[model samples]
Target: MCGIVGFSGKESKEILKRMNDEIFHRGPDEEGFYQDKYVNLASRRLSIIDVLSGKQPIHNETKSIWLVWNGEIYNFKELRNELLKKGHKFYTDHSDSETIVHLYEEYGIDFINKINGMFAIALWDSKNKELILIRDRMGQKPLFYSFVNNEIIFSSEIKGILKYPYYKKEPNFEALNHYFTFKNIPAPFTPFKNIYSLFPGEVLIFDVEKKKKKQFKYWEIDFLKTNNDNIEEITYNIRNLLEDSVKKRMISDVPIGAYLSGGLDSSSVVSIMSKYSNSKIKTFSLGYTTFLEHKNQDIIAARKISNILDTDHYEYFMSPQELIDDLPNVLRSFDAPFSGAISTFFLTKLISKHVKVALSGDGADELFGSYLAPRLSQPLYYFEKIYKKIKSGYQLSNEDKIKLKPFENNIKFLENLYLKSNGNFEKWKYEILLFKDEEKKRLLNNGVFEYDKFNSFDLLKKDVENLKALDPLNRALELEWKTLLPDHVLAFVDFLSMVHSVEVRSPFLDYRLVEYVASLPGNLKIKNGNIKDILKKSLKGILPDKIINRKKEGFVLPVFWWLKNELKSFIFENLNEHELKNSVFNYEYVKFLLDSYYNNKENDFKLAAKIWNIVSFKIWWDLYFK
Candidate 1:
């Protein structure tokens, strides 16, 4: 909901001001600043709640502590009421920003555990001479920090930190490798060396005198023991949690709306929102002209949901040219390479035009085992077991066999690795088959051909190890919550929405709701090969039957078709060997993929991912480092 930037060692006021000015779009309502010998904190405010008294860089009554915060504290009213009864006084009843100073006074560093909201809080403890940075439990908000020249600089966006003269602009190779494999840069590792992102549910405390920083995990998900709770109880509890989450996120002083993808997640959110609102709620959906030809677009279903819910709906059908035109800006907005580009960027832009804040259903798929991998778990498990038994002795020619023994072992290894890595066997197999010997040497420079040897796989394994007691389903859900939810889905949502200065809240990502649902048995989440079964049952009476039963269509773009149609020239122009030679990709392989797409021999989604990755790299290179 706002932009916050500061430096904690030897930063001039001019540099801090410049950094704050760059993020004005995030908070255009007002700006505040606090400067001292050791620290300079600045905030750009968007007046969402308590507009008048919410002016930030807020401080305690004693002026011993100052805080510049981003995001909404949904339970601030409850916290405020509690603090008031405990003899804490407030100058204005207008802002959640004031609640932080009092909460810190009452609970100290542990205050984060007591609050339920999405926030990246930077608390300046003048008395203790330490600065504490906290990211919310679900990482709905981002906090980027760098340690340089005996100073700690932190901001809401990477660009903000780049504004400082002392900040170095260099790509971290480890991060690039992770990006290539995972399609996203994992947390605690930014694209730049020395710059790091605070992981979700993490708190970083910087001690000035000692020149030391320490991080602690304040929260984590606990596996639900198999319970005998019946379907009725499960459905009832799910309905209550979802409705409560939606209601809590609806607290806004400005206009609010919902993104109606017409998919179960978005439609369910809008359905709950409509029931809470006195008037018809405004909703937005995005599609493309090519969607008419695909016969699988969700616009028709979205229209049905809108009509059934009696909401004011706005739909935008983007042309291929429009999507191509937005590519440069969208790529620049993301600091690192991403997988799904066109659809997420354009959809987010369209939603921002109508509403300052919108509620989304991003976390449902991860939480409810709704993706293809979770749905196909049984088949994949069987396939792995069968392959393991016959793989060594199966007779085939060298060309036909494809040397999958290494990859087969790799997939099996991933089963014991992390839940996120387990279902990626197909992708791994493809990577291995496509990864030429020369390409491996070119990318890695070292002789590291084993995918399981990567730090990312190890990190995943460590996370899964912590959840050893859970079943595969629960373990996988935990891994998604730790990895995919923050890295891919939430990162995409945050950057795209913030690029247009729109605040997006995910009701499904509410920690309480996630924990509650996570406690249910696996059958409640996915039953009889159906994903989100419990969610569908819970919404049976609340949502239209058409929506409840609609096949889950994710936010997918027509990348394959675009590479052959409207985007051919655009992609070709930027993808020549000369332009991409400096990138960490095989130019010949890229050319071959493009040729295959043009010759109608391949679905170019994977190739498009490569193209987008390189394009995103080029754009980010020019924007931040150039």
Candidate 2:
């Protein structure tokens, strides 16, 4: 719920102040700093819990160790009770933040393992001349650090580190190429050459005098095992765990709300939250122009749920032009090229306006096999068998070829084909049309991937094989959890919300909840081609039947229609040949894609993805490098 920054070795007060100032939106309530001979720690406070009592750079009575931390520690109260029993004294009764100094005193580096919350912590051991940085178990919070000339600089956002005097601006092309392949750069590698993000459940320790750093993983998810429990027992356990998770996240001193998408995940959270509150809970929903086109839009279902639950609800509708205008600012906030289309960006912005803290439905899809692709796998499995048998000694017809492409493209499709049964052809076609073959070749040549050293197809195949034990649907969910959830979904939420100084929490992503859901038998998750079966069963009485059985209409935006209408001029202006020629993409390819998309010869959502990536890259480049 806050932004933190610090630098050790050759410190400048001005640099620290600037870093903290840039992220004032994240923590406008209070600011704290600690500077000494070997270390400096600074924090911007959001004042979520213990507003008056909880302060950053807080320390034990003796003041030997200081802490600046972001994120909430859900189990802080329980930890505090244990600490108090062990003779640890406290000045305040805040849940999580207060336990840090005492825990560090009790267990030192081992204290991170004892924490069960989402946090990016920077602790300075003044007496020991050591500094430690820790990211939460699932990377719910971000921590970035760079080693620069006998000094280590770390911050909650890359922009904060950029404020330091000695930081460099070189782009990491390797990560850029990875971004092209995965649509998101993986952890430990960022867009910047030297800057790195601490992976989930990882910790970094630096010794100031020796100028040395080392990192180690503290936790990882094991999907291979399941709890030895019956379906009813598992369901009851899951309900209890989720209820506790939501209740803990609701511990805010300021006003808080829920992002109710009318989907199972968000509704479940809202339902549980309503139970614990004395009055109606506040909820927000984002809708689009496309909702009018569809018979079953999320808003309608959200309204039904809201009426039944009796929560105060707010809804916002966004136009394509507004999204286009906000693109540059949104990308700059991310400090990297993150292409989530535009729904994610606008949705976060809409919610940030109404609530300082909002709970989202991000992790539910990954945990409960809720994606359409996973639900379709059973049908696709039989279809693949029939197609194989009929194709002997004969080439597939043009139509058949198009239908079968997802199966042959790569192993990732095994999961995709099952989950949603939609092929990537539409996206790929748009991408191909956007640029000519020559442009693609040139981009491949200049891109982040080294074609000689690594074959993208082979690498994808290996990743698929690694998940052999998982069914196609489960594998896809796992991949999405590792890559898409962290890189695209979480990144979009973090940047957009933080831009308005709002904090977002996803209870579904609680490690305990994720593990429990993953351990359940797949049948409990999806049945009769329906996703979130177990979740639906659990919410039968709590939520309206209309919502419990509603078809999953994901957060939808009318981007395709907008590109042809309201956004045509805006898209053309930024993606013109002249603009693209000055950058890494080929101008001819960029022009072709725009023309194809406008002409409607093919669906060009994938082309839109590519375009968004370039636009985000350009915006990030201008902000940090220019």
Cα RMSD of all models vs. native, in order, equals 5.7, 5.0
Deviation of model 2 at 571, angstroms: 1.3
In candidate 1 the C-alpha lDDT for residue 191 amounts to: 81
For candidate 2, the per-residue lDDT at 4 reads 95
lDDT for every model? Answer: 0.75, 0.73
User: For model 1, what is the error of residue 611's alpha carbon versus the real structure, in angstroms, after optimal superposition?
Assistant: 3.6
Q: What tens-digit string does per-residue lDDT give for candidate 2 at 195-253?
A: 99998788899999988988998876656666688767877887888888888888877
Which 10-residue window of candidate 2 scores lowest in summed lDDT? 425-434
Query: Tens digit of lDDT per residue, candidate 1, span 99-170?
Result: 999999999998888887899999999888899999999888999999887789999988788888888788
| Model 1, runs deviating above 4 Å | 224-227, 292-296, 341-344, 382-469, 581-584, 602-604, 622-626
Pairs that clash in candidate 1:
none
